[model samples]
Target chain A: MSSPLYELGEPVLRATGLSKLYARRSSDTRARLGEVAGRVLFGRPPKEIQSLRKHEFWALKDISCELHQGEALGIIGLNGSGKTTFLRILAGQILPDGGEVWINGSSAAMIDLQAGFQASASGQENIFLRAAALGFTRAQTEHRLNEIIEFSELGDAIAAPMSSYSSGMKMRLAFSVMAIVEPDVLFIDEVLAVGDFRFRQKCLARIREMRERSAFVFVSHGMGDIALFCDRVIVLHKGKIHFEGPPKEAIEIYESLDEPASAVDTPAQLTKAMGPTFTNSGALKDVAHFWCDESGAPVTNIAFSDNVHLSLEFTSTVDIKRLILGVPVWNLNAHYTTGLSTQLASEELSVRTGERLKFLLEIRGGIANPGTLKSMMTILDGAEFLYRNPNPDLVIENAGHPTWGVVTIPHQWNLIERQ
Target chain B: MTEKLLNTRKERAKGVRIYRPDSRIRQNGLQAVISISREIRNFRSHITTLFTSDFRKGYRGTVLGIFWNFVLPMVPISVYIMLVSLRIMPRYEGLSPAVYISFNVTIWFLLTGLIRQPIQVVKSKNTEMMKTAIPLSAAIVSSFAQLCFDTFVRIALVVVIILAMQAATKWTALFIVPIILSASIFCLGLGLLLSILNVIYRDIERVITILLQYGIFLSGVIFPLASLGPLVSLSAANPFNVFISSAREAAFAGSISQPGALAAWTVVGVILFLYSAWFFYLMEYRIRGSSE
Candidate 1:
């Protein structure tokens, strides 16, 4: 999969012993004075009392990564895992306390979106300011003016102060100026966070487009995005690269949470279709069945579209008569998705003592949204509720859109838009 | 490991594209010195942006676009000079009161500007430094550059006043250049030092205003330096005094009595600069480890 596109004649970029040491600031006034005093061979001054306290932190430490020309390097980590910090260090926004970071291309960093913008300046003015901060020359900014403006879509507000802009609007202008005016190495720090879903898609596409002409150091918490966009994904933890390779494996390693499985559907109807033959002594107690995988192990993240089955083995300790059962699917958030009740056609089952019936519900594919969805089954004696149980947090993911509310009605839009 | 990295970079180089910072800076010395030139070259544009931004941030959402930038001390600078000339000049030599007032105003403008700048340089630090790779001194530099612009404007006004006075231009007028250079270095050094102090403490802002007010009157900005006698000599000890004296020597006097003023202040400025730079570099490392 990693076929080299260029001849191996030269090295474009090398991060040799690439290290970043962030010196943490401490509030030891006496210690500082002593250090200064020691350096000068003098008695330490009395610890002066200053009411200001600032501490230093290492946002990035000993990070080393190499990006070939046209290679998209994805930095995946949780918030504050130093992904953005590493990108910024590479971008040369701040100097490392120790070590050297060498890159062989023009680098631009969006460490924080619109980092240098003056809110009082108009979007047009800020475009110029931000462009220059991004290392573009006046002539270059001038050449890309139309493209930037169009992408910004700031319209009449281009002449208005950025303070008057909405957060989305500001990101719009910043993204437009930087993306339209390409750099040799573009560092994006979760820029997908700025805009709404649709605009985020557009920005992602633009980032990909820019990758053709430049390299990208993209930091994101979204595994799907990293998998889709990056050529190589690195998972960072605590200012270090924990895993480096394919995004899928990285995602599996990244999300090591034992998230629970969801259910397929709620058994809808419970009706007996047989002649009523009943031993009144018969009773079904506790219909709540714990869901497990094919290996008979308790499993989570059970897909609604999976052949994975949910089995309800109700114990019939009494001589049961005309037992009716009902099943309801409820998500982890306590929202019910779909419910099904037991149905029998023209027959009623007479259970003997200590009889246990195991009903397996099988899913064809996986659930649409395999997030935490729970399930519950209830058994009613004849038309009266003898026993019922509700098991919450049974996550069943579907092979469809994770719907907003509980019930999802199956319907199709048959009409075309009017001409 | 070296072989793998070299191989990847080798292929990358074959692609014929390189980031500006990643590549050589032409000369042999360049590859060693990170192109900090970009930081210096962007100096003017940064100030232009900051001045425009500050002018707005200082008064935005207020009904008064306030025009507060020029008006803050512009009135005191004018009114104080007039009051001083009325109170003192006629008692001294029947010299044109306008001459004393004009000179006083120009000196006050430059001195007050220098006094106000170092404290404000700190404000720029708390906001802009940690976010970008922009050096901590850059914010101070931009503010100092603005002060230079202010000094230029005041000097222009002072020149117009002298022409109106029908005074002869002196050989000492050449002294103004050295004076400005000294004042610039002095102001920048002071600004850098204060900016560092300010990041640690909040009270520097208020204290600086007090310093500026008392400094203006004591530096003989509102009154002639000669009237204060030995007190004026003490005023001359103030680096800002050299700023005024240099301007006076260039524009007003035939010759300044103090020969070594400019050289002394220049040395003081350099010392302050080096000290502040060292202090800032030390703290800069510490500040980054703290939460924003």
Candidate 2:
């Protein structure tokens, strides 16, 4: 995520031990009234005395980070890990209870994309309204109006009231306006989770183009996006910075901190018959799932160039015929990455009841897309699923090339001069 | 954070903003007033833009559009004049009943508008202010601008009536300026205070609505409060009563009763405005946080 344009040492944003505390108990109206009454009767006692008396816990505690120009910083964490609290403090939307944050230039937080839009106003009017909210002058907004309209691809719909717009169209207009504004520092919280695939790609490209002038602080649960955008990543755990450095190593630590993936109890709907003729005769249970390298030792992490041997162990409850194994890989966002199945295999196999079978599906090279990937093992007889083993996620550590999409295909290019 | 970096010319050029636990800006009354003035000035464009949109949105689908500003007040004025002419209500003294009722009713509308608009704006805009960087000052000012537009039109209508009646326009009538200014400042102060409290207490808006419904009768918009006996002194102490009645007397007859009381309340109004604005600024973040 680094580039030659990055001013490596010129930090535009700096935070020193920023922390925020939230009251565990709600500060009810009665308590607030009593506090006011006490102040009026006894006069001002002291600062922090009342707050200290209340039950409070720090949502963020002594966390610090710095960002230089043209660099993007990624923050990733589980729920309640303080990622959002840290981002809010840095964005200046919420003040930290302790410590200091200094930004050398203006910053804009795209926390809620449609925050200021007027439902009854037309898209054309709303663009100006949103521009004003962003502190843009009329002249500046006018200058960029045509480009924004062209980028949004709203065309005739721009004249229609925003209430009539589909949510995707609204997101397009909002993102186009913000992306065009180009603040000195940008704080984005999961805005890319919206829009279609094409629009998201356009937004990412726009952000990459804006990197020359802006530094980004991005918060997302998607590891692929984190690896794609951030030059440095901070993994927050329990209100503290548990890991910080390169995206790859930080992601590794973040994944390791989570409880290892365990077997999900098979839902009843999946075990139901797909057709009237099909009956629930047998079920499969996952015993072991892991990936290994050429040495045949269980490898918890796999690199892109390494030969991948996906080993799975399962036992069937009844005798099954013409059963084929299906291995489906999915990214953390539940996006299908790739499908590896024995459906295309020429040979079919049969298994007896209570027989424990181990199957290994080997790939010449590892998955190109990098992130923590989950795999489901499905034993299919034609179209009906006899057994589905979906537990124990497969983690892909690294990719050889920076690419977009679920899986990158092996390809090459050759230069030739035509006579 | 070093002092050099805090306010240095180079840092200013880069727009360095530093926030700490005690980073709240400490300002006295005069400084707070100055800061608020500067913020209003810097956001004047936002004020105008929001004002134009809000004003237009008020009458967007109507046939008459801006004329409703005049139409709304005329209905009340006409009804009161008819009642007075029909001998159903006591006549307004010292001026033509039509002129007096129309003029006083216009002023009363202005007062009611000043009292009512702020709470509505702050409530409707609670989401916008909390979710975005739009300053509360800009929203307040823009809503004030709409009221200003309406008041300007109503005053124009009053002037036309005065010209048609050929009443002697006295030079001393200029006293109405201070009367309106003081009243506006006082209502704005009270409105702002209530708007902040209204975010935490949902009943404040309803209470204000009920109070305004009874305010016109108590203020002697149609007839003198002298008939009410004990309510005369009671109305004198009421700022709305003092300002409206004083303004009416000044504009129609060139003299205001209880000038000393009006002056005292004017001073009070100025102090209230300053304190309320300062209080609003201090509680701004807290109010926004609680608005959700």
| Candidate of highest TM-score | 2
Clash list (residue pairs), candidate 2:
none
> Per-residue lDDT for A142 in model 1?
78
- Candidate 1: tens digits of C-alpha lDDT, residues A92-193: 554443345656656667767767788778888788777665556667777888888887777899999888999999998888876865666777787776
Query: lDDT tens string, model 2, B140-189?
Result: 78888877777777787778877886666667689889789899888888
Candidate 2 lDDT over A251-315, as tens digits, reads 77776565323322233333231111222444665456677766667876777666778777778
Q: DockQ for model 1? A: 0.17
As for model 1, its CA RMSD to the true structure in angstroms is 9.3
Can you tell me which runs of candidate 2 are displaced by over 4 Å? A1-5, A21-59, A78-85, A179-183, A191-202, A220-229, A254-419, B1-14, B63-87, B163-169
Task: List DockQ for all candidates.
Answer: 0.17, 0.37
TM-score of chain B of 1: 0.69
